[model samples]
Target: MSLRDMNCTFSPAALDAPDVASLLAELDGWAISGARLERRFALRDYHETIAFVNALAWMTHQQDHHPDLLVTYNSCTVSYCTHSAGGSLTNNDFICAAKADALYAQRAGA
Candidate 1:
């Protein structure tokens, strides 16, 4: 399913690794780290890093699906999973990953 088709109220069935693998392929710079979908964004500097993080925060807030963010001087690592699914990966994770990719791409293109 497309990321736009996903909602915050995802069923807790937890997509299997194979299914998650397919979804991950469509998300740029994202990887499956055990049961979590993870990605690291390397920005030009701390300012860019924070801008990316704030953009991501706004997106997550709108979606009501937040990821764990690890911020540094010039990078941020985002990790996502469904706590409702016993900490398993779900479509919501991939959905947010896709949105995050688009946000980063747009920033880069600008």
Candidate 2:
């Protein structure tokens, strides 16, 4: 789906609200965690994972919104919470999440 389509799924104000556990469950298999748009992603190898993180960093910089990122030897985890909203989720979070997912898909295809 396009970014616009994804954007239509959430609103800036709505994202800051509490999360819905059931909605999050839908993305469980994609390695995303948490509710209300707070999610995590895990990669298989250090090289690939780091590359993905770098891409995410670049995207975050462009968006001017950041996520909590943790990197390990062969895995990376990302937590999305709008700091401006007091550690909650925002539309920006999901926008970044979708972009990251696209990046991950591109890497996997490569």
Candidate 3:
């Protein structure tokens, strides 16, 4: 199944570099920053940015996996890392990343 279809669970195991790389291939625009999976979405304006944030928030809230959000006038950078998995990248991070991509794509008409 695609990561977007996967839900966050009690994952105590962290992913290694090789595994992270392979999973990254399944996602778009996300990259490893330290121990987190991050991606920045550029929107049209502040209104659009906040609207996107709200939409993303709703989706992530359903998954029960929240990401660190850095929002500006036209962009929002989302970073995800599972603290339950030793503060490193986990399958939860990748799953959320894929969902983020889908959300952004819908907003961007891609």
Candidate 4:
């Protein structure tokens, strides 16, 4: 199954550098900066940005995995790392990253 199709369960292990790099390739507009998987979505305006944030919030809430979001007037920067795994990047990060990409695609119609 695709990452987005999979659910995030409790995992205490962090992904290794090679695994993280491989998974990062499967995600669009996402990059690895330190231990976090990061992406920035550019929206038309504040309204769209907030809408995207709220939608993403709900999705993450359902998965029980929250991301650090930097919101602005026209963009939202999302960063994900597993605090439960000692702030390292885990499989949950990539799974949620794929879901976030799907959300952005549907919301932005891109």
Candidate 5:
């Protein structure tokens, strides 16, 4: 599935291992760990890190999907999994992962 041009909501459905593998290929900086999609990003500073988190919060809200975020002084680790899908990988996870990547790119360009 191509997620680059996607703009949609997260409808939860469990993905099989093969399907998850195919989708993960198209997502940069993201990997499947256990049942979740995970990505780690290093930002410029504490301020930038928080800014990134805030931006991500807004984006996830708009998509109606959320990820587990771990924030440090200059780093963020985002983990996505759908509880509705019995804690498995879903399109929502990849969709939000793609959106998070876009937000990071925009921040980097600025």
Candidate 6:
């Protein structure tokens, strides 16, 4: 399914009990860091890494929310947090994380 693009103003509720495990599994490597989801991406080079960050920036802009992005010569680390919610996770974090995963998969053809 496509990543949710609607502005998710919903608060973080305990996901349906049964779905929690599956969702956690999908986000295994990308774990909860601080108030959001965190993931690291390793690219082929600086150019590819920058390209990836640019794409992510565009997505973030479209969503009207931003993430904490750390870009290096060949790696990019992303952390999604909703400041208004204090130090807590939210659906927006997961939505953005899933979108990033989709983008990575599309770029890697995997």
- List the global CA lDDT of all models: 0.86, 0.62, 0.89, 0.92, 0.85, 0.71
Better of 1 and 6 by lDDT: 1
Could you say which candidate leads in TM-score?
Answer: 4
In candidate 5, the residue pairs with backbone N, CA or C atoms under 3 Å apart (3 or more residues apart, or in different chains) clash, namely none
Candidate 4 lands at a TM-score of 0.95
Candidate 4 clashes: the total is 0
Pick out the ten consecutive residues of candidate 4 with the lowest summed lDDT: 101-110
**Model number with the top lDDT:** 4
Q: What TM-score goes with each of the models? A: 0.89, 0.68, 0.93, 0.95, 0.91, 0.76
Give the better candidate number (1 or 4) by TM-score: 4
- Kindly list the per-residue Cα lDDT of model 5 for residues 4-81, writing each as its tens digit: 456555456688989999889988888878778999999989999999999999988887778899999989999999
RMSD of 4: 1.1
**What would the per-residue lDDT of candidate 1 be over residues 15-70, giving only the tens digit for each residue?**
88789878877877888787789999989999889999999999999988899999
Deviation (Å) of 10 in candidate 5: 5.6
- Candidate 5 overall lDDT versus native: 0.85
Candidate 1, pairs of clashing residues: none
For residues 22-107, write the lDDT of model 2, one tens digit per residue. 33443433333554344456677788888888988887787777778778877666777666666555566666666767776787
Candidate 6, 68: how far from true, in Å? 0.1
Off-target runs (Cα >4 Å) in candidate 2 are 1-11, 14-38, 108-110
The local lDDT score (0 to 100) that residue 70 gets in candidate 2 is 78
Superposed model 6: Cα runs more than 4 Å off: 1-7, 10-22, 108-110
Question: By summed lDDT, which 10 consecutive residues of candidate 6 come out lowest?
Answer: 12-21
Give the deviation of candidate 3 from the true structure as CA RMSD.
1.4
- When sorted by lDDT, best at the front, the candidate numbers are 4, 3, 1, 5, 6, 2
